[model samples]
Target: MNRSSFIRRLSLVAAAGFASLFATSAALAQAAPPAAMRETMAIGDEPGRVSTEEVIIREGAFARQLVFFRSTEPVGTLVIHTSERFLYLVLGNNRALRYGIGVGREGFTWSGLVRVSRKAEWPDWTPPPEMIERQPYLPRFMAGGPGNPMGSRALYLGSTIYRIHGTNQPETIGHAVSSGCFRLANGDVIDLYSRVQTGTKVVIRHAATL
Candidate 1:
């Protein structure tokens, strides 16, 4: 074959090979699992980016479970044991639905009896004055979403700046890292939110009290 003719044939073959590769990639992508099914958990700092830490928290000991609990509090009450990093919803008959939680760090920890004054789903977040003062780099206001630190739900505690809320950082569960709020994995918080309502009694027990 002449040089021009041979070059034209080679070019056609190269184009066809590239097209085939693209087609195969598209097909594989279509066959792959959905992102939601594949990614079970995400971190607050990087939303939708799954990591080993996220998987360990979501499927490890931190996952929510029903457990035998001894509490004088009536059924439907919320009990938080900050030292153990667990929150229990009194279910009567000496039982409770327990969720792993992230409590306040060091000086931020407190114990008190409070009530759920209100609730919100995917609530907007405004860093409290104190929080902003401590971490001046934080946003003044952040709209709620997957990327938002507030996560999926929030149960406001009485009139205090504290709340039992969801965190995008599932790995934070079973740790002490919050400013003062009690945080749960997004799924766990959503479950808790559905089972409680405004006016629900919340008893917070710190390490000293527990």
Candidate 2:
């Protein structure tokens, strides 16, 4: 073939190859999970970015950490301030396991001085009258199990209905969407439950200050 004729044929072949590769990639993308399913978990800042890297629990997941997000505070108490979305378990040398929590919404929010009066593994959940009334579609009570909204562990806060409990809805870990309950990820709650015992002081501070 002449030089110009050979060049034209080569260019045509390259274009066809590029088109085939693009087709394959589009098909693979379509076969993957739906866009809604892809967004089941929260993605901060960037939309598609997710941190699946496993958080290593050195001793236990509940074994406290040594850092405080809030600059002011002595470091040896369990302070839960819902409005701020922080749960600080002070480790004394100026730090705490600052787990992001989903606090109660609007009228459902509350504040009080309570203690961790009871602890349970995979605790049963009976929606309070207000909760049942608010979300009537939910079952009156859900048995303790893996799928239960109250996750792997629970620390009942005093004699009231509030609890630092594990949530099946792990994606809601750091938001304001509960009924006056302090909600955590299942892994974190189980860790917290194991270290603390009954009568551990649980001070629900003003959500604004903590």
Candidate 3:
């Protein structure tokens, strides 16, 4: 081939090689799990270990994940969909850290906007009077520890009795079992606690239909 034609062919070969390399890299990235997914949990000498622990309790879409989510809510806002049994922490870039949550039973479910009024690590548990009336066996007060149903951390929502807190019972993560709040595994709550702050906006959607 002439010099120019030979150079042109070489250029085509170089372009093809570059494209193949790019494609391979993209495929590898798509196949690999996120850094946290490669592991189980993030721990510490005490609670409040981190802000993004991946505890895969069951095999389904409700398992916690950081995924693309488009919404008008600002980053750092929290959106809870009770019917779907999921809570999403908005992370901007059309993405969110979605967590499987145990919401309230039918009669106990609620919906509205609330703010993170406070947060606690290994929080104490004091079953409200109303709760005790429903379950008289429950203790009126329990100090913070492993046995506390509030788990490793508690993010108090507004002035309401409800709180987004950790749970000793990880299996309850995706059920409508609570009186009316969000609950995550202890490890996951620590992770979430590390991410959120007081005054963070929390929006709860009661239903998904007309």
Candidate 4:
């Protein structure tokens, strides 16, 4: 073939190859797995952003950390020292994932062994009738999202109204603020949620000491 004819043929071949590759990519994208399209168990309720400002506590007891936890409890046990505002997950080696949390105020305190019966990500909030009676200004029900008081995830405790959940108020961490619930930062809750499954043991300390 002459020079110009040969160059034109090569250009045509290149264009056809590009078109084929594009089609294949589009097809693959369309056939993507449902899991891929579904939301991740990230800290934030916002799409494409896996974190929220409410989860950020730059320096405080509520900061997420791995600490030396001396306990005889089996691995995967969730231990909460309500007075200390600390929640610990027994890691089986004198270690635990310690997270700061907000405990319930005086009349709402409870201490006992409970199991995580259910878990939900970015869970909705519904104030119990008693809570509504106490705070008439509060919303009856709040949908789950960035604005939701339940920040990112919630672990329901033994079918009770109380839950271990994420909080919209970062300042509440390491304080007694909730009606009866234990509140963690969204980032910390997401981390905790990933480490525990439904039916996990939860021990809440209500005694004079941990």
Candidate 5:
């Protein structure tokens, strides 16, 4: 083959190869599960499987931090403001450790005084019958782990099914997305689990009460 013809043929081959690689990458991206579905691997549930990037909370407002807060609740009290999507652990003297949270959506939101009835690390998840009725596709039971919708820890609230637990879906923080549970980032929830004990008071309030 002539030198110029050979060069032209090589260039075409390279272009075709590049195009194929690009197409493959795009297809893989499309095939990958969305952020919401990563954690469950189950159908019709919360977000995607957990990953380092997905686990790191990127929203500034949702990041856990100490903040100035005025409340009559005791130092150890957990005050959850559903409207603001914040769970505050009272630190006394007008300050508290605030955590971004995901609360129950519209019809699922509730408010009242309750206590921490129990705590568990990597707690197993059992979809309540009511929850199953609503989302029939959900698994009846799921073992806790990184991929579990319940993330790293759980503080059972009162005798109710509600809990303040860690969530695999960090993006859900600062949003109303649960059945009635209050969810924090795994790290934040672990910190919270360490600070509180069983029988600790939890005050849940809506925006109107605030």
Candidate 6:
């Protein structure tokens, strides 16, 4: 082969090698589990409607797991997985606070990165357009109070309308039953809201339960 042709063939071989390397890298990335939050609960039942008998009994089953929340130290990041109905608060030293939660409906879910931009005590309930459209009977907005859908505390997730907040409907803690927000039990939300501060990162990963 002429000098020019030999060089051209060498270039082609180099390009093919690079392509193979790129494909291998992509495959490895796919095989690795994402460094994202994982959920531990199933999606069933509705909020505010669980029977009282369950209140005492259910906690024992879930409570036996490793403790995830620590109050004595500074707050950490939080992640909520809608599909698994679980929330994870990342604590330093490889520890974390994990809690069961309720998520949105079939098509009423969202997942992305956000921060706890604001917090409230006994926050008001303002139904969003999508929420109202879903439940036409729901009021446009409900003032903050014990009876409001937003229970005792609300941790606003940055500029987005989403939130990881307390819910008046505790029965929905381990179910899929919200418009698109992450709903925690009143006690759990209160505990979390106090520990987390504004500007804490929150990642929502919605996927199948483990």
Best by the lDDT measure: 5
Looking at candidate 3, the ten consecutive residues that score lowest on lDDT are: 36-45
lDDT of 2 at 43: 15
Better of 3 and 5 by lDDT: 5
Residue 91, model 5: Cα distance from true site in angstroms: 0.4
Give per-residue CA lDDT, model 2, range 79-198, as digits (tens).
Answer: 886555667876655556666665544212457667788899888878666555545676777778776666677888777777887665444544554233677666777777766778
Clashing residue pair totals per candidate (backbone < 3 A) = 0, 1, 3, 0, 10, 2
Per-residue lDDT of candidate 5, residues 1-210 (tens digit): 153244335544653565456545422233433233222111124433444222434337777788999999888999988767788999999999888887744213457899999999888888667667656777898887776777788999888877988776565566555343788878788888999999999998775521
Collision pairs in model 5: 35-48, 36-47, 36-48, 37-47, 37-48, 38-47, 38-48, 38-49, 39-48, 39-49
Ranking by lDDT: 5, 4, 1, 3, 6, 2
For candidate 1, write residues 123-148 as lDDT tens digits: 88886675565456778888876666
Off by more than 4 A, model 6? 1-75, 106-108, 130-138, 178-180, 208-210
Instruction: Say which candidate scores most in TM-score.
Output: 5
**Model 1 residue pairs with clashes:** none
User: Per-residue alpha-carbon lDDT of model 4 for 11-125, expressed as tens digits?
Assistant: 4465356545654542223332222112111121222122355454545456778899999888999999865778999998899988988774421345788899999998987
Tell me the whole-model lDDT of each prediction, alpha carbons only.
Answer: 0.66, 0.55, 0.65, 0.66, 0.68, 0.58
RMSD in angstroms, candidate 2? Answer: 16.4
Clashes of 2: 1
The CA-based lDDT of model 6 is what? Answer: 0.58
Q: Using TM-score as the measure, name the better of candidate 4 and candidate 5.
A: 5
Taking every candidate in turn, the Cα RMSD to the unseen true structure, in Å, is 17.7, 16.4, 19.1, 20.7, 13.9, 19.3
In candidate 3, which residue pairs get closer than 3 Å at backbone N, Cα or C atoms, i.e. clash? 50-191, 51-191, 69-94
Could you give candidate 3's per-residue lDDT for residues 1-210 as a string of tens digits?
Answer: 153245335544654565456545422233433221222111111222222233334345656798888989999999987667788999998999998776643213456888999999988987656566645676688888775667778999888876898866554555554233577777777878999999999998765432
Worst 10 residues of 4 by lDDT: 36-45
Model 4 lDDT, full chain set? 0.66
- TM-scores for all candidates? 0.68, 0.61, 0.67, 0.68, 0.70, 0.62
